[model samples]
Target chain A: MAALNYIRSNEKKLKVIKSNSITFDNDTKPMAQHQLQPENWVDLYADYLFNYAIGRISDSEVAKDLVQETFMAGLKSAKNYKGDAAERTWLIAILKRKVIDYYRKINSNKGKAEVRMNYSAQSDAEGDWLEEQVADPFSSFENSNIENEELGLAIQDCISKLPKKQALVFTMKTIQGISTEDICNELDINPSNLWVMIHRARTALMDCLNQNWF
Target chain B: MISCEKAAIICNKAQYREATFIEKLKLRFHLLMCKTCSKATKKNTQLTSLCDKANLHSLTENDKLKMKEILQEKD
Candidate 1:
């Protein structure tokens, strides 16, 4: 049936909704999450926006707010959504904006000194030995088999603990899903230097995750 | 003339997928004969995805309510 086709194709969002536990903020209730129509905003996009926030802020509390803010905004703008993308994707886009806005606002209000590193993908392999830079040998791994703790969190911790430059490069490449060239431009590092830093970041993260995640 | 050490550097960026094509071919050719670099590449990658696979945190009920309140504040 058409419904079955939709369900199977949209399984990722469906899985999120089915597994989601909806929550609301206490500040000014959008009063929209409480809307009792068949569509529960929280269940539908909770994990997506929540994950988006966590990825951006890396702080649990702030990430939580970002999700809530996203939902509130989505609720108001739901009519404009138009089902062009998955609900989760739409909500995530909104959350990304909120995160950027948070940084912009905080920067102005605090007026504190901060080193703003612009990440860029303007890079190319230095030369030969690119095989080392090719596919990650372990890309085919089944991480689901090892279940000590969330490897992602453990890795993020290790990444955060890395040298500032290494961490920034690693974060941009992995988390922001940006390119190395862009990261180099953002950090103003040469390709060779970028490779070295990335190596350090990887080694540290690999060790951290291997020891801790398992 | 990628020495084993330089090979290691290239191998490192490869894990991050920052390597170029010919560099990969060179590294691969070396890896075909160099056991040490091959093992290093394997171990390095095993570690990278382990961390990359880590899931981002999710929101809770209290924060959702707070967000609602924030939005409604202006309304």
Candidate 2:
């Protein structure tokens, strides 16, 4: 009889508790949708965004400008923000667009010379692999050794040595692991061009690594 | 019936995970018979993994702070 009385008394309290979450949701809609603070974003994502841009742009000054542009765009679109992605991802997406735009403008003006590979050097006139090009069967290049700081620096140096367009494609595709379709769309290059650039980059890096590490 | 040079290209495409299934099978078949191309493929894959392992290119703290101030001024 005592237990039943206690249960009866708490029924109204349980109902109130059940409705509290609904009341809280109704009150916090605007706050939930509010844009992330700009200052905090600098603390959180500036380095990341800058690095991402610099890797592709290959110039710190230009990279910084691009990041700044991303922030400005973000601020402009803050009111229309939808909370689908994390703020960092959203910022990076904006930065990607800016980088793509920057390249598109550069490409339009200069029509930068394509980095042509001397296929004849690596293969026969008929395009068969030359014995010299395949001189060594394999030289053990271990990438699993994460503690290999020297190897890392060597790779960075090699990447820096690549032609600007090749470096951009290499960083975006190989290092950043961005999709090939996105890379082609962003750089305004076809898939065949992207593949050629990537191939040249890999060959260059391999030769560099072989000379430096192995 | 892909030549070694073509096999090498396909091997590279495979390293980027961009090779078609048929191309991948072709490359695999080529590698099974050609020791030189197989070794080349291994090195190519290693290069990609090394790049992944060495992935810490970021802006300096000072620059980040400067960016923050710059962005703040626009607000």
Candidate 3:
């Protein structure tokens, strides 16, 4: 009878182990599932999305509007978010569309004529000739614009690769130009600590950008 | 003479225009003798200009608050 009871308890222990493993699996499942947090969106993603839009559009007012619209569109379509991408990635995708739509709208409106005129004004030697009015393939302005955009994106990419606190400190000081005291107060760090973070961030950023930018 | 590490700190502060006049003088003196620190300073300055050229801008606190309000109202 004692041997029989021992076997019964071992079986019970096996069942308990199996159940524990199942619970562990469930605990980890939600971590893999991304959830939208709209309340934190502004604080977390506004700057990032703004930088992205401004890099492409070069207008603060329009970039701000695009970021706002992207948030609205994100909220409206939050139900359809499949959690396949991170929250920032998803918001950026929406912002990209808003930027394209803005350009399309301008292209289809009276602004198109102004743009064409501006292009023609640059190549005055051609003097109103229809074929010559087209944008010069080798225009320095166009080339620089493309280069600047690529450089901007590359800088943003490097910033994103920094550790979270470093990225926050670097962006606030370098990009946003927030005062050191304000940054210290906002982040609840001492002045020296803030400086340390800034130093480390600058070092890491330079190293990262040197690989691609310099 | 400040150590290379301290010079690096001052160099970073100068990049943000926060280094004091004395600190700036010290950093400059240090850079004059130290090749590595001077190279780092040059790259650091270049990085600052690149950032400026990028024209990266973020929403102001008021703008962020407005965004939050808009999101809350829509939600």
Candidate 4:
């Protein structure tokens, strides 16, 4: 009788799995593509986009403004979204343009041109060609900055590849440094479950970084 | 005498500084006997340092809320 009951439960579980796969298959169909949830944009992509911006620009206030502008542009261009790329990817493409616009605005500003001319003039009485040709002593610092940005992008890419729950937990615990208890409360998970998720995330991240980074 | 699985759990906990004193001692003993786990621990430490070096920053809560407000207003 116990063995019969076990078989019944196994059948029930299989039915659930089969039905879930059916929905998953349907979701993957070309006609039924992924939908955007604009309301959840801030909760989902804000931090990731902010980090991407700040790493490139290294200015907190401008990064925040650019993130806001990206969302605004995303909303305006919602109809053009093909749903072929993931929502975050689409948003990132917008943010990239926003960042470029920011750089162009600053570079083309009248005040910035005056500042640049003043800097070159202060370097030497003669033409600034020699000053421009000489290698910067602090070039190593710039190189390290580029290296850190690349490393940061690699890590973010790996985190994005994780399951959504695992990514959220890992980011909260490791990157954001939120208290474990707080994460548990927010995610409605127990400590042990959190640890298991963390373990899985760390192991997967290590393997990914080994392949792509190390 | 702890299993490798147990040692790995302890090692992860140690990374967060959440392992108890006894758990850490047991992990140390396990690492001493287990070459594979010791190598893994080293890689895990390297991962931690790399994360630190990356210095990735996130948006503050208020900033995120402001962004949401802007989106809502436009929408």
Residue A55 CA displacement from its true place in model 1, Å: 9.9
For residues A1-214, write the lDDT of model 1, one tens digit per residue: 5455346447645645654533323213444332322145554455445654665676877777677766677767766755434455566688889999988877885546466553324445354555655767454343342321334444545655677567667666666667777777877888878777777777777677655444
Measured by TM-score, the strongest candidate is 4
TM-score of chain A of each: 0.37, 0.42, 0.57, 0.61
lDDT of 3 by residue, A6-52 (tens): 57557656866996787566657776667899988887777778888
Residue A95, model 3, lDDT: 94
Best by DockQ: 4
Q: For each candidate, report its DockQ versus the true two-chain complex.
A: 0.24, 0.22, 0.52, 0.58
Scored by Cα lDDT, where does model 2 land?
0.73
lDDT over C-alpha atoms for residue A66 of model 1:
71
How far residue A2's Cα lies from its native spot in candidate 1, in Å, is 36
The residue-by-residue lDDT of candidate 2 on A1-214, one tens digit each, is: 4455347447645766876766567556655543577767765566567667766787878998899889989998987777645587688899999999998888774447355677566454664457746755343343233234444556765766778688767866766678989988887999878887888899899998776555
- Model 1, B47: alpha-carbon shift in Å? 2.3
- For each candidate, what TM-score against the reference? 0.44, 0.44, 0.67, 0.69
Report the C-alpha lDDT of model 4 over A1-214, residue by residue, as the tens digit.
Answer: 5466457557656866987787677767898676789998887788778889997798899998999888888899899987866798899999999999998898896777664335454555576576777888654676567668778877887887889789888888888899889989988999889988988999999999887765
By DockQ, the candidates rank as 4, 3, 1, 2
CAPRI quality band, candidate 1: acceptable
Superposition TM-score, candidate 3 onto the true structure: 0.67
- Collision count of model 4: 0
